[model samples]
Every structure is written in structure tokens, then in C-alpha cells.
Target chain A: MRRPDHQTTTLTAEAVLAPYLREQAASFLRGLRLQREHSAPADAGTQRADEAARALRHAARRISGTLHTFRGALEPVWADQLRAELAWLSGTLAREHAYATRLGRLLDALHQLSGASLPAARPPSGEGASETDKERAALGVGAARAGALLERRLTLARTRAHSAALQALGSSRFHAVADAVALLASEVPLSPSAAEPAGLVLHAPAELAEQRMLDAVAALPPDEAVEPYNEAHDALWHQARQLLRLHRYAHELLRGAPDPALVGPGHALDLHRDAAEAAAAASAAARTPRIAPATAYALGVLHADQRHEVEAARGVFRETWPHAAAVTAS
Target chain B: MRRPDHQTTTLTAEAVLAPYLREQAASFLRGLRLQREHSAPADAGTQRADEAARALRHAARRISGTLHTFRGALEPVWADQLRAELAWLSGTLAREHAYATRLGRLLDALHQLSGASLPAARPPSGEGASETDKERAALGVGAARAGALLERRLTLARTRAHSAALQALGSSRFHAVADAVALLASEVPLSPSAAEPAGLVLHAPAELAEQRMLDAVAALPPDEAVEPYNEAHDALWHQARQLLRLHRYAHELLRGAPDPALVGPGHALDLHRDAAEAAAAASAAARTPRIAPATAYALGVLHADQRHEVEAARGVFRETWPHAAAVTAS
Candidate 1:
């Protein structure tokens, strides 16, 4: 996809920021409402409320991302503090949502794997199904149990997140955010640079994001697979994930109008980040003491599977980055 | 689906049993091969091994089911012993597969829900995507986390399963099973009743299975939803599940030649059994202690959701059975 024109990108940022912030603020509020609804007696079902939680998280993220991308346009202190507050809110909602989603994702991936899996498992026809069909059914039963375990853990996490959200809702900072949102157009102390016409907004953040991604990749040891369990490996992966996240959000600033080439990498990068995160979770689960021996065995399987996926994702990223770089380089 | 003609169904049973047993034994051996392959030096990938594990499970189940479904034809002592060992083998394989599958199913369901879900999470997007699309992306992140948590635990369960499988393959009982499978056709324990024509074969098992299913369902409390928690509820659900399994097997004996009316109810019954099992799992998960408050809350959400599904299944059963009764009665 051709690079979006820089001149238009700058104007796009200026034109969109105020409305964008308002929309984000509105999204946050909307999510907050659903959060409250879930804890209430009404049977709104978790579906809506879950979306709300995600909305609040994404809005907060984009808000922060926008502030960073357009830092020169606003007062430094105000942006910093507001960003902090939004981060808190996002983190709060993310806590439970993250766990719940991860549990869901892993379970799904395992089953999906079951479908095309293990042709040798094909049962002799007089009794049952062919390989994957029968195995898939059996896996379905096990997946239920695994899901149950996750649900228990995720419920507890969500309880804590909701509590945190409630506290934040009532805090002075929350009030300040609300007031700031109400007067967002006038309150953001715009500087002379805010009016710059050359419009480096989209290109600037994208360029910064790519450099950071490259630097993160550079910092990695020659072979992560050698001792991926170590702290350095984990920290480096985390740093790269954050950089990738920044890049994704930077692209989001294109307001869905991003260069077409950017889209695929955005998804690929998310997968890379998630695979790394899942591998880490698998390792941690392995170390959790006093679990049933069977449970321990299962976790080990999950860990190995995830570790393999992590390696695959890294490979994917290595392959994907050059294309993205080439597209944007021109 | 119309109930299958019992005349043809009876013929199907006779044709299927020997081949079924042979196929099951073959499946068992094949699965054993994959299981060993996994623990070997080269990476065979967990997907293949996992399928192997499940194949072992289904093979054992079918062997046991066939022995039960055709009990009169085989030697009483031999059948009992074989059933016992197969049950043990099946249970061993199942302990791990069940956990893995449950994890996958729940995570997948949750993510699917996330996509059409979290309506309030609709971000104000100038991007090309709609509300659900954007919300789904955000939910994807959270789902990834939830999946990670499950992957950890499932890996542990699978590790144990593999170990257990390795042990079983080396056991005296396993050896006996193998011997029995090898000499299955030549075994001298056949009763004169084995030649008693097709009269007693099909309908007897069907009648017996239906009676058992009905008995188990009758044992369920007047209102299952009022209190699905206690030991009795669990035991009854388990019994019903087993009965359903038998019925499904009996139906499979008919293959595509089933009594036309049996087909719909067969599928419905499978769903019924699954929903009930899932609900039980959810309840158990909810009872597990020391989870975070958020996790507990999430468990409750899962518990409630499964409970509703269970009740819905019950309703579906109630609706389906009457139609089946009318059709079969005629």
C-alpha cells in the first residue's frame, strides 16, 4: 500500500484529535456503564459488558497513544497526568479482561488444533469417527475442564478489576478526567507547534515506532530459544511487545485509514506479542506448586505448545518486518 | 431425522460389533505408537501426540461400550474383566485429554462471544471497521491472556496423561487387554445365545438403553435448577451422561441405518449430555478456593452461564423426547 501523504496525515491528526478524544472519552464512559451493569442483577449477559470493558481499555490506550503521537501539540504536564489516569483505568479493566480472554484464546486454539490433528487417531468405523472427528470430540470434553479452571481464576481477577474500576470512578482524578473530557477542546493547552501545517503526525509516529521495533529486535540475544526462560529473554520480549503495541496504536491513529500494508503486520505483531505472553504463562503455570500431578502434566504440555508457538511467532515477525519496512521506506 | 427401521438396525449391530472391536483395538495400537513418538527425541508436535492420547481413550470407550451393548454374546467373566481394564485405560487417557479439550472449548466460546459481544466497547473509530469489529480486536487481546492461563494448566495435565499412558502400556492389565484383542475372534467363551438370530440384538439394547436414560433422568430432582450443586445432582448427571453414551453407541450400531426417529434425539441427547457435564464442571470450578476475588467472580459468571445452558438443554430434551416418543410409539 502506498504511504499515506504526510501533508494530509498532519491535517488528519489536527482535525481528528478533539473529536477523537471526545469519542474515546465517550467510549470509556460507555464501557464504565456496562461494567456497572454486569455487577448488577439484570441479565444483560456478559457479552455486552465484556465489550464495554474492552472498549474502555482500547479507548484509554488510544488516548495515551494519541497524547504520545501528538505530544508537541498539548501542554506537557497535563498530557502526562491525563495519560497516567487513563492508563490506570485501562490497566484496571485490562486485569480481568486479559485473563479471561487468554483463557478463551488458548482453549479455542487447542480445539482448533484438534480439528486437523492426529490422523492416526482415526477410530475404526464400526465404532466411531475418523481421526480428528473423534479426537475433536474427546478434546471437547477435556477443553471443558480446562475452561472451568480458567473461569475460576478469571472470575477472581475480574472481581478485583471491577473493584479497582469502582474506586477509580469515584476518585478525584476521575472527576478531573470527566471535567477535562467535557472541556477537551478548550482545556488542552495548545502550543504554537499545534498549528504546524506540514503534518508529520502520522509519519512521525510511524517512523518512531519502526525504529523502536528495530532496536528491540537488535537487543535480542542471537538465540532466544537457547534460554528463553531467563529474565533477560522475558524482559526483552516484553520491551518488543510494548514497541509493537506502540506501532499498532500509531497505525490506529490513521483512524482505520492506514496504508494497506500496515494492516497485516498489525495482526501479525499482535500474534507475536500474544504468543510470547502465552509461553510465559505456560512456564509460570508449570512452577505453581501443589497442583495435582495430572494438572501439572497438562500444564507442561501447554507450556511446550506455547513455547513452540512463541518461536514460530518470532519467526513470523522476522519475516513480516522486512516487508513492512520496505513498504514504509518508500 | 426419522427413526431408523429396527429391522435394518438389528442387522447393522451384528455386522458392526466384530469390526468395531477390531477397529477399536487398531486405534488403540496406533495411538500407542504416536504416544511413544512424542516422548522420543525428535519433535513430533503435541498435536499428533494429543490426538493419539484421545484415540486411546475412544478406543477403550468403544471396546467397553460394545462389550456392554452385546453382553449376552460374550463370556460373562471375560467381558467383565475386559470392561474393567478398558475402563481403567480409558479413564487414564481421559484424565489428560478432558482437561486439554475443556480448556480449548471454553476459550474458543469466549472469543466467539467476544466478537459479537461487548457492544458497549464500540470504539469511536474513523477506521474502516464497525463497532463489533473494533471491539472484537480489543477483546482479542484479553482473550489472548485468558488463553495463556489455560495453556499453562493444560500442559501440566497432558504431561501427566502421557506419563500415565506410558505406564499403562507397560502394565499387566494392559498386556491382558492386548492379548484379548489379539485372540478376540478365536476366544472360546461364546455362548450358544450368540447365534440366537437378530431378534434380541437391536431392540433389546435400544430398549435397555432408553430405559436406563429415562431412569437416570427421572432420578434428577424435580427442578434441577433449584439446586444442581449437591452430590446427588452430580451423581445423577454422571449416570445420565453414561446412559446417554450407551444410547449413542446403540444408535451408532445402526449407522446411517438408524431408526429414522432416533437420529434427531440422538444429536439432541449428545448436546444434552455435554451441557450438563459442562455445568457440573463450572460448578466445581466455582467451588475451588483461594482464587482471586476477580477470578471467583469470573467463575461465577461461567457457572451461571453453564447452568443456563444446562437448563436449556434440559428444556431441549423435554421438547425432543416427546416427539421421539410419539414417533417411536407409532
Candidate 2:
């Protein structure tokens, strides 16, 4: 890795991205340290770890996304390898969180059906006591058992994800990635193209990101987004969410911050992703062999709840996109 | 209060209804005794009380609905007064349960948005640690506070309802109602028409109940039931739910049990009622003055979730209604 002349750097791609990369690298390292220090059994410590995880995940996404978007300005081989490693790291960290989220969603939905708001409160009434008898009388007999089944499955999945994430964090490969990031904080491996003017280097990709997102948004069938929500459309909407995210990240790279026009739609997309994934988890849980009809019925209801969430998110996106598009165009 | 001669009793409306009234009165008394004996501080005792409440409520609904349905065969003044007292008793008992149910629903929805499935688990993390940092990072800043605020308001409401229910149970009016029920167990106050044949007295009213329910079901706009769930339709669906319940009760009186054909649609209506009510609670919570934007956002998501639930329930009802109607017609 050779450095461009200090005077030349002021006008080159290296000048703009070197600082951004360095900041993300530092945040990643700092998150690793904080996560280790805050790994206590208390709720506070777990929260700190989760926060550290978020910081780490955020930095990883920005670095990986930037590397891809700016590959022309960087050493191609090194950028590809680093991007792959960041992807691996992000995936590992996110797995347990995904399971936890899905479990929380399913259990909350079950509680909704059972009319048992406080499952922790062991009602003195025996059998079917989690809810008021009125609720139980209406909700039928499968809620408690359904909840227990979902809990058992999801808890196991989360625990396994936790173990896998821990294993990855401790692996030699993770350490290698960490070492590479540390070195990059001080010296980025740049290509001959890195000497190009910053705007000339970044503008094409930024525009492409925006165009791709707009195309996806335009492709969504406005007609199907409402009544009789089709699951098939969920994939298309999820792609739009991904594209919007890429566009936001590209804006951050080119403009030093995400586009203000993108924020509202970004939030709606995040909701769409969470809800769609939650609905899938509920559907999976509903398929447990030999489960009680009541349990199946409750899971069906839960699945429907998430699907509605998916539609609701889509509704928000539809409402927000026109305004966002106008703002962006202007 | 009078009994017809033994030979004529077999053919009279009183012959058919007296046994039903006696059985309900006995169950109500039994429920009262169980509730008093089991009113301990433990979860089990609370559950016992809840069950007793259910039994009492069930008996009251049955007796009250029966009186209304069979008013032609019963003494009007006595029937109306007793029905009014039963309504009072049922309302008092149901109020606490309703609040508890609504609170549970809101709390669960909050938990769903927060991504905190196990709120009881005081994780090592502090502050926003109720959810995975990933969830908090995505859900925005208002979730914990929103949850706290909703919990406070709903908890207070539930407590007040509990107090009112307790006060009602201890009132002299409750004792008077109980005395009337006990007397009815042995002797029903009958109009001269009570001597009419059982089929002549009960069949027309039972048929009327079924007709009303059918008409309401027919009035529902199938087009609005899917995406873009309109809240205005919720009240109409709720009315349908009530009518269905009345129809089921009428069937029980004529057929010795609820019409088997009605069971599937009945469950769907129950779901519709629950989801519609939950959506309203979520909307109300969202309107709390001076709440943070994040809190409001979360509530908006929750309200949407419940609305989806309402639609889901409607979907169920729609799917089941045709089959139920076919079976009932057969």
C-alpha cells in the first residue's frame, strides 16, 4: 500500500473516504471493548452489550457498503476480502438478535390472543389461569400450550445463535479481520483511481443507488398493497427496503450524511423488515407437528397479526414515498 | 309464582324453562360460594375468583338472554327487573376483566414493538435494555417511556375497575338479585301465556334471533374487510358479534346446546370482538397528550397491529360464515 502525496490527497478520493473509514474502524474497535466490559448478568450490562453490538453492526454495514460502492477507488482484492469478512461478522452478531426478536414477537402475539398481559403473574386459579376466565372462555383452550411451545423452540434457537456468535467473536478469523481494520484505521489500501477528484469518483454510484431504489419503489403494485395482502408481494417490498437502505448509505458516502428525504421511508422499511420476518417465524411455529388445534389456531392468528403489520408498513411506505421522491428530485 | 297442574306441566312453556332457570340459579350460587372461599392472595386464588366470575357471568348472560327471548311466556314486570339486575351484576363483574384484558393487550403490543419478549428478565443491560440493542436502535427512542406511560394509565384503570367490582359484590342490591335468583330456582313468575305449548312459545323467538344475526352478517361490506381496514366497520362487526352470541344462546334454548354449525363462526366473532377492542385501546393510548414522538410512533405501530388483527378476525369470519350458514340451513 503506497500513499498518495499529502498535497494530492486534498483533491483525491482518499481525502474524503480515509476519515470516514477511520471513524468506522475506531467505532468498531470501541464497540468490541465496551461489549467485553459490559457482559455482566444484570439487565444493564446486557443492554450495554446490545448497544455495543449495535455500534459494531452499524460500523460494519457502513464499511462493507462503502467498500462495494467505492471499489473503483480502492484496492480491489483487499476490498473484496474485507467486505466478505465484515459480512460474516455482521451475520454472526445479528443471528441471536434476530431469534430474540422473533421470539418476542411470537410470544407477545400469543399473549394477545390469550388475554394474558402479565404472564409473569401466576394467577391463583388452576389450569388456564394465565388469563381471566372470560378471556380463556373466549380464546379457547390452546393459548398457554401454544405459548409454551413457541417459547421452547425460539429459546433454543436464540441460545444456539448466542453460542455461535460467541464462537465467531473468539475465532482466529475474527481476530484477523480485527487486525486488518486496525491497520486500515492508519493506512488505507488505495488504487491508482483513488487519486481522482472525490465528486468524480463517488457521484456515479450514488446516483445509481438512488435510481435503483426509485425503480424498485415504482415497480411495487399499489393495487395489491391493500386489502387481501398477498405474501408474494412481501419479497418485492423487502427488496425495496434493501434498496432504500443502499441509497441511504450511498447518500452518507457522497454527502457526509444520509439524505433527509430518505429518513421517513427508511423507518417504514425497517418496520416492514421486522414485521415480515416476525410473520415468517409465526408461520414456522404453527407447523410444529402434533401441536394442539388450539395452538395451531392461535399461531394462525399470530401469523395474521404479523401479515397485517407487513401491510401496515407497506401502507406507510406508500404514503411517504411520493413526498420523499419529490424532496429528493428537488 | 304458580305451577300448573302436573299433567299440564309437561306441555307448558314453564315445564321447559323452569328446569333451565333452576340449573342456572344453582350454578350462580355455587360460583358465589367458590369465589368467596377461594379469594386468597395467591395466583391460584385469584384464578379461582376469576373462574367463579366466569361462571357467575355465564349464568347471568344465559338467564338474562333467556328472559328477553322468552318474554312472551314470562311475567313482564318480574322478567324485566330481574334482567336489569342480572345486567348490572354482569357489567360489574366484566369491568375489571375488561380493563385487565386491555392493559395486557397494550403492554404486549408495547413489548412487541420494543422487542423485549421477557420483560421480567432484568437483563444485565440498563435503560433501553428491555429490548435487544438492535431492536431499540431500530425502534427509536420512545419505546420504554411509552410502555411505562401506558402501563401506568392502564394499571390505574384496572385497579379502579377491581375496586368497583368488589364494591358491587358487597352491595345490598347484589343480595337482592341473589335472592330473586334463588327464588326463581324453585318457582318462576309466569304470565298466563306460560301455559302455551313449549314449541309455540319458544320457536318463533329462536327463529327471530337467527334472522337478526343473519341480516347483520349480510350487511358487512366484504370489499372493505381487507387492506385499509376502516375503523368505522369495526362497530358494525361488533354488532354482528353480539347478534351471533344472541343466536347461539337462542339455539341453546331450543336445541339443548348451541348449534354445532354456529361454533366456527362464533369463535371468529369472538376474535373479531377482541381484536377490535384491542385496536381501540391502542388508538386511545396513542392520543395521550404530551407523549413523545417515539412513544406515539410505537403506539401507531401497535394500533396498526391490532387493526390487522381486526382484519384477520374478519377474514376468519368470512371464511367460516358460508360454511356455517350452509350447515345451519341444512
Candidate 3:
């Protein structure tokens, strides 16, 4: 889904609210487009269908994040009710998004890293060149086999996620979320406090949202305690990652006056989350109750790899952290 | 060591030969410096020593590759024997480089991916900002523990490689190789065929080398036959990768006038080797005799990842191979 279009001449509460609602509606329409081709069943195999599913989830998340940040600006009861419904639609779309994106990402990585040999472009000249070119193309026997395996399993996962998404879309609860979002564009319910002044309503919440993010970061366990070996530390880092995410979404609502601190710093925590997940996967692989020695060794290699990553990330954080930078600059 | 320095006043066989030996000697001296810092035994914990070990291995490989490429330029008996010795030295250093580089690369990825929030720049113009900054820095406790685990394991591997390298240096066999290389600079024994004309010496084998590389590529199984599901297919890809490697070495002997078809197209095969090895590692992990289902699943995932990489490399080869370019340029 697109970011909220805040290029309105007026920056009222309703104006800001309209853009957010429009963003959600745009995503909902995209999801509907995915299922329009078939009468009875939905097919997830189409690349456009997959993109629509991801777009729908992204829209739901942004709507929910905006609600959390600016609940005070809107009518409390209506805002709370729509927030719950948005969360449901988001959950419905999440599984499909996760599986589809993961498969897409892995395939992309393989393409990048497989390391292509010199690409044999067609020569404008003679026929002998084309004959050998064809002969050389015949030698890429291993790639075709590998592609088939990934397509089967990943497609299955994507289809299953899509089927679940289709079922959720047909449900009454989802329709209710759609209706609420549709109403938001024209008949937005703003609180008395927000109705009185345009500047106070938008700017205060933006600043508070940034403040809350900092508070969340402060609550996380200190770096010295988040040692790579400590199991407890990953949980803390995970919490920090979540908080950083919330901060990012909060800033997205105020995209016009962007806050670099609120958005980009969260990216650093993305690595922390990845390292933790990788370590956890390795651990699960290792602790596979009655694990094989070879499996255990492989798990060891993976664990070591991720743990090393955790350290490297921490080193980078220490180097680039704005707090550290501020201290050095001062 | 650096690749051969070909920007020369006179590109004679010995002129080219002298630079290669000097490059290897420079790398050797650097390794010796690492060990000499201590009166006692070598310690792998020193980052400098680890760097030296890797440098030495790189130097050895280039020397060995060059020896293979231009064996005709020197005495047949001397060249073949010294090539073998250089390979032994290279193999010893390879173990350490492989482990160290892998650990380093993985760690770098973690840093890139970890999503950190609030890159705290210069603390706000207040006392409270500094307080929180100090508090936040203390929170990265998990990374330290993980770092320690990787350090201990990687350092041990590095130390073991260094010890092996040191022992080889002291042996009479290595001394013989060193003496042979030293003699190469001054009293070089040249084959009569090579001594005749400098132009003939370089060109004949280069052409032969290119032809051999092409023959090897042609020998590999066609793309349709190589399926990921069949274990037999992986073996064929492995053989192709080896031939590509030999071809790359052959061309390193004539780096002054590079054959793009010769040098780069082999990189496609480099990924093939990596994928094969990764798959082998995963297979070993899977076959851990009485393997647990979880361990087996993890190994399966790892295997699938590498197998996918193999397919990607093949796809790339099919696209980029410069067969048409070679003929068109000619």
C-alpha cells in the first residue's frame, strides 16, 4: 500500500485521517483484485496476487500503527473499535505475506549469489558462434533441477497462505473492518480537543510517539548484559526490535515531516532480530531431541555463524549509534 | 599475494616469473613476522597472526596456480615437484582461511541486518540525554557472550592452521621448494622450446590452455540431465567446477592479455563448487547415523538452500557465458 498522501492544502485532523483511511482502502481494493479473476476459488500462483496480499498486510499494519499513535486525536470509541478490526485483517494476511516474501527473498539471493559466468550475448555476426553458444547453454544442467524443488515447496506454502487469506476475506469481521475504513475518508470522528486546533493535534502526537520509542529503547537491557551467549539477552533484544518497529510506524503517520531517528535506527535492530532467529533455528536444530552428530555439527556451524554476526552487529552499533556519536562530537 | 604485475618494460618469461616469486616471498615474510613477535610458541588469539596465516595461504595458492599454468617455462622435473610442494603448503593455509573468512562474512551480515532503533546522535542539549546514552550502551549484553564463543572456536582453528604452516616451513621439503623458487630469479633452467622465442613461449600454451578449458566445459553434462533430486547430478556439476578451476589457473599464466571467456566464466563454476560443498556439508549433517527429525529437518533446509544456489549458478551460466562474444570479438 502507498504511504499516506499528506499533500493536502489543509492539515486538519480530518485531512490527516483521510489520507490514512485512503491508504487502507487502496490496499483492500488490491486484495479484492487478486480474487476477481476466479468465481469459486483463488489462485496464489500469480505474481500479482502475491504482491496484493503483501500490500494488504502492509496497509493493515500501518492503519493499526497509526491508531496506536494517535488514538487521542480521534473519537476514542470509534478509534478503539476500528483498531481491533484492523488487527484481525492484518493477522489474516500475515501468513501469506511471510511465506511468499521468504520464498521470493531466498530465490533472489540464490540468483545473486549463484554467481553467473560470462553471459553469452548473441553476436550480430556468423552462425558458428550461435552453435557453440547453444552447446554451452546445454551445460547448465544442475540449475534446472534445483529450481524445480524450490518451486514445488514454496508454491505449496504460498497457496496454503492464500487460501487462508481468501477464507478470512469472506468472513463478516473483515467486512466490518472494510466498512469502518471506508467511512473514515468522508465522515471522520475527531475529538473535541483535536477539532479546535490543527497544529496541536498532529504535532504533539508525532513528538510523543518519538518520545515513547526512546522510552522503550531505554527499558531494554543494557549492551553489557545482552551478551551473545546469554539466552535472556535475545528476548530483550527482540523486545527492543518490536519497540523500534512501533516507532517506525508512528513516524510513517507523520511522513511529511520525517524523523530520521524514529525510522532508520529501527533498521539496526532488524539485524538483531535476524541473528536471534538464526540462532534460535540453529538451537532448535541442535536440540532436536536425539540429534545426529552430523546434524549437531552443522547446527554448531550455523550457531557460530549467527553468534559471530551478533557480535559484529553490536560492534557496528557501538560505532554508529547516535548516542555514541553525540558523545564523540561533543 | 597480488596477481602477477604485467605492466612491465619488457614482458619476458623471466620478467613475469620474477615478480610472481617476489610476491610469494613478500607474503611468506609477513607470515614469519607474525610468529617472530613471540619468543615462545605462536598464539592464534592475536588478530594479526590470523591475518598473516590467511595472507600466507593466498600467496601459496597463486604460486601453485602459476606453476601449473607455466610448467613448460622451467625444467619439467623441477616444476612438477615444486608444484606439488606448493600445493601442500597452500592446503595447510586454506583450512584457516576458510574458517576465518566464513566467520567474518557471517558476522558482517548480522550487523547489516540487525534492526536497531534510535541511532542516538548528539544527546539533546541536556544532562538527561547523556544519562540515557550511558544506560543504552550498557544494554548490548547478548552480543558479548556470542562474540566470546566465536572467538574461542575460530581462534582455535586459526591456531591449528598456523601450527601446521610452521611445521611445514621447518621441514626439508619446504626448504627445497624455497630454494627452487630462489634459483628461479637468477639461474633459470628453460625448456629449449620455450627458449627459442619469447612470443612463441607465451602464445602456444595460452592457445592450448584456452582450448583445453573449452573442451572441459563441453565435456560437462547438458542442463536437462542435471536434476537437483538426483544425487548423481551433483557429482557431474562438481567435476565441471574442478575443470573450470583448472581453466581459470591456466589463464592466470597469461593475465597480461586476459580472456574474459577464460577468467570470469569460471566464477559461475565457483558458485557451483560452493553449492556442492554446502550441499555435501548438509548431507553429512543429515546422515548423522541416528539423526533426529528436527536435526534432519534443519539439515534438509540447509541442503535445499545450497541446492537452490547450484540451480541459480547454472541459470546464470546459461545467461552470461560469452560464447557469442568470443567469436564476435575474434
Best by lDDT: 2
Candidate 1 per-residue lDDT, tens place, B1-330, comes to 233455443553344455556666777777767776774525423677667767777667767887887777667688888888778877876766666656666565445433434322122233313422432343344335434544555567667776776687788987887777666643334555655544455467666776777676666555544222222233445556577667666565545333455555456555655554454443344334443322322332233344445555555655555434422412
Taking chain B only, the TM-score of every model is: 0.71, 0.86, 0.67
- Provide per-model DockQ scores: 0.02, 0.02, 0.07
Chain A TM-scores, per candidate, are: 0.75, 0.86, 0.68
How high is the lDDT of residue A55 in model 3?
67
Candidate number with greatest TM-score: 2
DockQ score of the complex predicted as candidate 1 = 0.02
Better of 1 and 2 by TM-score: 2
Using DockQ, give the best candidate's number: 3
- Give me the runs in candidate 2 sitting further than 4 Å from their true place: A1-11, A39-45, A117-141, A225-229, A323-330, B1-330
True contacts kept of each: 0.00, 0.01, 0.05
Query: Residue B101 lDDT in model 3?
Result: 58
* Clash number by candidate, in order: 72, 21, 50
Error of 1 at B250 (Å): 47
Residue B310's lDDT within candidate 2 is 71
Deviation in Å, model 2, residue A166 alpha carbon: 1.1
lDDT per residue, candidate 3, A206-302, as tens digits? 6666565556566555564223433334455555565556555655555543345433455556666566545444443344354344434334334
Worst 10 residues of 1 chain B by lDDT: B119-128
lDDT of 3 at B168: 76
Candidate 3 chain B, poorest ten consecutive residues by summed lDDT: B134-143
